[model samples]
Target: MLERLQAALDNNDAQGFSRELGNIAKLRSMAQLAKDTGLGRESLYKALSGEGNPSFGTILKVIHALGLKLNVQLPERTV
Candidate 1:
């Protein structure tokens, strides 16, 4: 799952990112995913469909629900 997300990030592709989000099984059914994200079904459709802009908080909840972490990678020279 992480690998798929990483690939999407590497490609900077929204559709790929969204498809990966949609693929999360542990996050529960699509309806549940929508409820957990505090977004309506259509909104969830747009969000994970990669067509709508979602709030950071909402995205955070989705990521958290997926048991994933958002992190920063410091450049080696920054140390």
Candidate 2:
């Protein structure tokens, strides 16, 4: 799931990222995820529903709460 989220982010696919987040939220209740991330449950739902624009900070918090971490990698170059 984390890998899928990272792929979405790397591809700059907002909807895909949101979907991955939604999946994660389903595994762990949104209310609990919200409490863990220090965000409002409804707000978190909106953000992960692909309908809300969440800030980078919010994304970071949510990722952390999910026990995931984001890493940077150089894009592969085609020969």
Point to the candidate with the largest lDDT: 2
What is every candidate's alpha-carbon RMSD to the true fold? Answer: 2.9, 2.1
lDDT for each of the candidates? Answer: 0.70, 0.84
Clashes of each: 0, 0
Candidate 2 overall lDDT versus native: 0.84
Residue 63's C-alpha lDDT in candidate 2?
81
For model 1, what is the error of residue 5's alpha carbon versus the real structure, in angstroms, after optimal superposition? 0.9
Q: Model 2, range 1-79, lDDT digits (tens) per residue?
A: 8788878888999878987987898698888888898899988888887778878788888888888777887879999
| Model 1 C-alpha lDDT versus the unseen true structure | 0.70
The weakest ten consecutive residues by lDDT in model 2 span 49-58
Give the alpha carbon lDDT tens digit for every residue of 1-79 in model 1.
7799878977877677776776673357767776766667676666775666666676677887666787867757854
